[model samples]
Target: MYRIMIADDEPMIRKGLQKLIQQSGQPIASLRLAENGIDALNQIRESCPDFLFTDIRMPKMDGLELCRHTAELDPDIQIVVVSGYNDFEYAQRCLSYGVKEYLLKPISKKTVEAALEKLVYLHSKHTSPAFVSVHRLEEWVGEAEAAIWSLNHETLVKVVQQARVEISSHRLRLHQLIDLLDEFTVLLFKRLHSRDIFLFTERAPLHAADDEDSAWSQFQARLVLFFDELRMKRRGKLKDPVEEAKLYIEAHLAEEVSLEDVAERIGLNASYFSQLFKQSTRETFVQYRTRRRMEKAKKLLAQPHYRITDISGEVGYADHPHFTKTFKKYAGCLPSEYRNKLGIDR
Candidate 1:
């Protein structure tokens, strides 16, 4: 079990962090907490952890000082900053000190899950001497050892990166790799919403390849084609609770929402709604909602009157970095890329 240490000045914050770390999939062998930096330092000398999560500011010894001193105690210990947006600049300073993740306060469960997921992913990816097998690659991609469905950005990055690494390493012969990857991405996508009707499509001609790279490249090209088709096919279209839920989302674009809230609005159970929504849309409700919001966000940003942060919050992202990641995923570029293109590149 991976050990975790959580530190914060506030009792409630520490309590919440403890709960989140427990739920984050990194099982607690021993969890030590401190009210401030000095207490944390004293504890670290006795018991070192694989990871340390600390708030930036506190009464006697703030998180920054704790993070710095903790590293001097154990440079190998991974650190993630848990603080407010105002503390981010200070958090950045901790990076030179060796912090792994910069977490913001008003912490979401998703954010915590993402952080632990990375540590878990890193631990497994680097330590296991096991050869990358077709089945094992898929298995690693799906590890829930903690709940990851609601997580975003970094968690998603870890998942996608693991998938990319296991698949892209030229681990198999070119033709075989393509066939394996072609099947893998397809199954992963379809499995999420397997209960719904799937519009089947033709697969790429793997047998056509006389060489490895050509075959793999052809397969990747086809995969891209298939996703583009899938996206276009699903975009702005509605079925099941999908249409009603999306209408609700679009209508309440600026307000706070939860899975339960959306379910209640449509008089459907959250589990059933989540599954069916993913089934029909080939994306989770959160993903679909974010995609739509980003679509609107891009349009709004293209206009002269909108402020980026205000638009970010309006679209349901409390953090601009979160919004930026969501924007880049759907648009295949950054917001500033779009902005700069309009101002001068055009």
Candidate 2:
């Protein structure tokens, strides 16, 4: 499915084009209209549509400049220019920017169809690539660590969706796919451990499922839950030096938050602060923090909008697997199960 946008100064022209495109029964997944180049540009930035149609003359920004800006922002987007002028210079200028079709003012269904045929062919040629390679998948997992940790739901969902697509396309054996998921989960754990965050939970043993679909579904669900608790180990409150340390931890949950770092921030000896935190909270600083994180995680899990990965980082665990494990230990159920018990649709 391809998304398309049309930008024109004339309201009638824009509505006509939209109607024509819909009536043509083309493979257009969606069609949007913008009154002028500025609105069109904003839409392009937000949706990054695969196709665009614009008039040569418009208020605020002309079609030529829109073409230039679109080329810079998304060179892959196919563009068709509609103009009243048949000037050769306009044609040459549009050609220089890789505009797909140059239609005259009196546009017809036949001409639009001809332009769409070319655009569809180009779109096909551009999008027939296979799944992402394993190397690239690893790179994305590493790059997504921060978003996964910070509870950035938008970025996290995008990355997870990409990974899901790649995994589905690979068609690996059930065991092989499980191994891949395990490897990725381990990478997340390694990232968290590097920051001295410790995590423990009952490892849900993987069985030989009948098919890859079951395993993949289970794995992704677990990962979603794991991500939900990533930052649980960093949220909490305390007294005096411990209170200051807790505040510091809350403010820096997305960073490499460490006991030493917080202790230093509060002008307390790290060793003494550790003992003091345990005495004050009846749990070690880490345990206290994890408990607080679990509390926050429970609240976030109740909301359908929060991704588990984002919640994991929000509470401060970067390694999603570890976050999941520790969350289960604290909450006595997997995050997803917790969400279900709360009668929420995840």
Candidate 3:
């Protein structure tokens, strides 16, 4: 029978992990919950658990301090650090305190199961020598970090897949894979931090996997989904504002349409929207509106029923000579000349 403790500020996370450990069918002798690192430390002193799952950021003594204290109190207890974001520097600090496994936020059944399995393995090997030395662990972690920093998603996925396969093949322990993945995630996020991408910010809870292969497969699927959804979201962001601005300009061709008015309609700052509009459409607002009005005047001129003055008014111009000069500049011909080219005369 193994005693386990979950330390987190979130009631839901603590209760949820407790339920998952009980349902995993692991020989869990007892389960305990703590709202923060201080409470967790008190609980440990009162009754030292064989294993602990803790969140890095917590009130009244963060997970890092708790890990350090736990190490001094009970060096034999295995700990898995739980967190949401990937802070590589912070992870290195935690690793110094003997934390080998990391569980990402919104943890699911599969992750919980894997974590517990790793804890069980640690429990079994507590009195025995470690198969992989500390030096080897650092080497693998370095390799994982390099793959993530290279920014080649395919190569990174392949590297992670290879590691996953080793775990599935039983050549590597589950805890070791979790450590690599945790490092990879931290490096990946640090690389992508300045890109304004929100892939890791919010995530739904993933379901538990029954085995290593299933866990790895789920990880791959989530990556693909992240790229697909991120692409679609960014495309929409670039396309939507310009398209809406164009529609508004087209609808009010005879009225004043300033950048501020169009930006207001789109719920964006005028200067920012102006930049985005030009970036997306490759034309300044003045140039685009002038071209649109000239095009409309040309079409109306083709009808032969509308006079030059009416056509000018239709295209938002009240002065005939000014409109004529503008038409000649845009269309390379006077309005009458354009009508003649179209074989029409009033």
Candidate 4:
């Protein structure tokens, strides 16, 4: 859906265009009106309109001035000049701004239709190509590690491919950018398997577009906005009911922290909490707790401070036999083999 803005000092022209645009039933999903260039500038700043229709002349600020402002604001905004004159000089000047189509006023629905058709087509080609988005996603992730902390060749290649395939079903939009920040926070502190790919993809889109300094400001804003959105969502504090349940599981990994006890503490039905936890994290509560244990188990194995039996107990396996099977499931190696590899720091 394209959002369109019409800027004209004349009330009749603005209203008439708005009505004509709506009546035409064109592809434009939303239409906004600004009485003059000043009002139009505010609208441009607030919401980046997909298209702008402006008269060539106005009193305090002319259309040329508006075009210049809009260019500084967002170069991607498509402008279609509405003029009552046929002066080629003005046309030549507009070419510098890359105006889409200069329409002579006393305009009809047909002229507006043609302008929208061209604008929409151009936007798609520039912004939404399938392979281009995927390629950009990959390149963005691959570059991020170099810009911050380098990844090994194996990890770099693996991460970019994982990011491309696992960006979630979520689509990017101006508003959803807020929620993404919250998601980022969750990913940062949450337990991650070696395969978790989000921190790579999370920054990929921004890296694809801006430098570190500029992107950092925007990234922080997204997080702030997300907290605001969370307040809205919970109607109070960002009520994450599953948090306590996760905490309890972590505290009692060896004791068989069943879904029943964890869910009961959160005051939610056990089955329902189980589903929501899985839905949000892509891992069931049991699986996540076990994975966390295994990760701890690996870290302990790497350290020479603890013996193998002690490490198994540390990761919540009372029986070394049980720890061995679980380690094999995740590591494809017995606990002793993994421990031996760590002796030389492989």
- CA lDDT of each prediction against the hidden true structure: 0.68, 0.75, 0.72, 0.67
**What is candidate 3's local distance difference test score?**
0.72
Task: Flag clash pairs in model 1.
Answer: none
Off by over 4 Å in 1: 124-346
The TM-scores, one per candidate, come to 0.36, 0.44, 0.37, 0.44
When 1 and 4 are scored with lDDT, the better candidate is 1
Candidate achieving higher TM-score, 1 or 2 = 2
Residue lDDT tens for model 1, 1-346: 6778888889999998899888876677888888888888777765567788888878788887888887776666788888786655685698989888888778899999998888777755643542357677567535421112333335544654565565566444333355565665566455434535444344433444545556545544444443433443455333345677888889887776777899888766576567556655778877777778888888878876677777788787888898888888888888778777778332
The weakest ten consecutive residues by lDDT in model 3 span: 198-207
lDDT of 1: 0.68
lDDT over C-alpha atoms for residue 276 of model 4: 54
Which should have the higher TM-score, number 3 or number 4?
Answer: 4
Give one digit per residue, the lDDT tens place, for model 3 in 1-346: 7778899998888888888888898877778899999999988876678788999999999999999999987777899999997888778988899886877888889988898888788777763432445564455445544554444567657766665554444443333334344454444444444455443322222334434465566555544433433443555544466778999899887776798999888776676666556645668898899899998897898787798898888888878799999999998989899989888876
- lDDT-wise, the better of 1 and 2 is 2
- lDDT winner between candidates 3 and 4: 3
**Distance from true position, residue 134, model 4, in Å?**
13
TM-score between model 2 and native: 0.44
| Candidate 2 per-residue C-alpha lDDT over 202-236 given as tens digits, one digit per residue, 9 for 90 to 100 | 22434445466776666555555445445333443
lDDT over C-alpha atoms for residue 52 of model 4: 94
Tens digits of lDDT, candidate 4, 256-291: 667888878766667556655764566888789989
